[model samples]
Target: MSSVLAKVDWKSQGFRYFPLKLHYQRLFATRVQKISLDGGFTCPNVDGTVAIGGCTFCDNRAFSPSRRVRRDAIQAQIERGITGLRRRYKLEKFIAYFQPATNTYGPLDKLKTLWDTALEDPRIVGLVVGTRPDCVPDEVLDLLDEYAQKTYVSLELGIQTIHDASLHWMNRGHDHAVSMEAMQRVTDRGFEVSLHVMLGLPGETSEMMLQTADQVAKWNPAGVKLHNLYAVERTPLADQVRAGEVRLMELAEYIQILADFIERLPEQIVIERISGDAPPKNLVAPEWCLHKGSIIRSLTDELVRRDSYQGKNCRMQGLPREPS
Candidate 1:
């Protein structure tokens, strides 16, 4: 290498390879807000259709703020949320994200009422329903499709991994087949789909993570959330971490794996989020990855340093055919 090139320090350069939030803001032409609504949705695992206690690594308490889970009418929750947000940010349009649990696991009208309540607020642009793949039904899909005609609607399906063994170990109620079927069904109805996939699951190698990204990109989803697995306090995985029964990847190692994952993903996929959101207070393991945007920043720096970019592996990848 040239002496001049060798002296160039990327650490000092400070540039991000893939900045996504800017793209979202540009599309909105303002601060596009996300108000997480509990909506009192319950998981299938806890509902006894699958298992109990939800995922072995899940603690909804860690994810929800106090205001989000208030036991009140859905409209009241939105009003209170908006009333609180009135001070800091003037967000004219927001996404009502049903974040706590499986949003589609209810009677058609019951679910419809919960969702329609969100639309009553003029500030609300649309709905962002978070649910397991298996929880979605035709009746729900029809509602989402019709809602999309009136406003923006994006379904965030938690298709964590394509590996069955990993799902089993994580106590995820549904399998990969369920995820595929859900995505196919959601897409066929012309509603936007954003998949939630995590990296570094138990027994899942980096190659397997890349395979999941390949499948997701091919599936023609509008958005994607790439999260890292962390052992949260009070979860079964935390016990394994304390006992040294489960291995946790270091931040740097995870960043390298995630860089590869990003390169394999399609550029068109709106990356909603890059890292897991386990606050230091609630996180029990993999403590090194808790420095907020450290993982995402490191991943971007690595990508730029390696001169890598997303969709670099698109042509060679044999992904399932979805609508163009």
Candidate 2:
């Protein structure tokens, strides 16, 4: 490794155990929490701008904490989210995260108005917008770029899977090419970018999941959010699971896949999430998915058992550096 990369204080820097959570602190010199704000945005696929019924596995309400929908005002949601998060975490600064739907799907003026409203609170130190690849346009990117100059900003694109079959299966409005193009545009403009991927998607094997990792590494994103596929009630995926057309990966199987996937990724890539949990009331299968704490412990134990760490076998090899 170059002396620059070798000098990273992995242990003290928190990369030895978990790198993603601490990445923001290291950059901003304090704990910066992300407050998920529902901006009442809709996806092209859901609105018939692309397709009709939305993604197969999607039910936006399932992922939302307060079950926030389009009717809720952005400011009220942020205030409520901040109050709860502050009481629990005692955090002072936060990033306004526009999560759930296609955050950048509207016109530049409307998008800016929402972003400005969310950022109006002085406590908010940054902004992170999550949206589909096809939803981002030059104007949206330009708006995000303007924010980049002022505060911490990251554009999280939900790329899900690189395989065409999986993309088609999910009824994602765009193809892999569009995702690549979106990523390139974000990176080329020197913006911090993060991508989301799901493991154990129907028909994807361990090898295929790792292949997605390989492709992601080549793109060199600043962060990644990894999730395990789980069936939720009232979604098309749940129907498929009930019909025995889809099989969710068990807890142990998902742990192994996650550990292996992390090893294959470049060490510098911040793991924004290891796995996702669906509310018990909304979940239909893979009962173990609700055990977040146990899963983390098991994952830590597995890593220790193998005496391995993130980037143990990256596609682009770098000389191992001692953890500080």
Report the error of model 1 at residue 216, Å.
1.2
Per-residue CA lDDT of model 1 for 263-318, tens digit only, reads 77765555678777787898987777667567666877788788876666654344
> Model 2: per-residue lDDT, tens digit, 47-141?
77888778998885433223334423877788888899988897888889988778887778777887888788898888899999998888889
After superposition, candidate 2 runs with Cα above 4 Å error: 1-8, 12-18, 60-72, 317-324
At residue 237, candidate 2 shows an lDDT of: 94
> Model 1 off-target regions past 4 Å?
1-23, 60-72, 83-90, 316-324
For candidate 2, the lDDT comes to: 0.79
Top-scoring candidate (lDDT): 2
Error of 1 at 102 (Å): 0.3
lDDT of 1 at 237: 87
Native-structure RMSD, model 1: 7.8
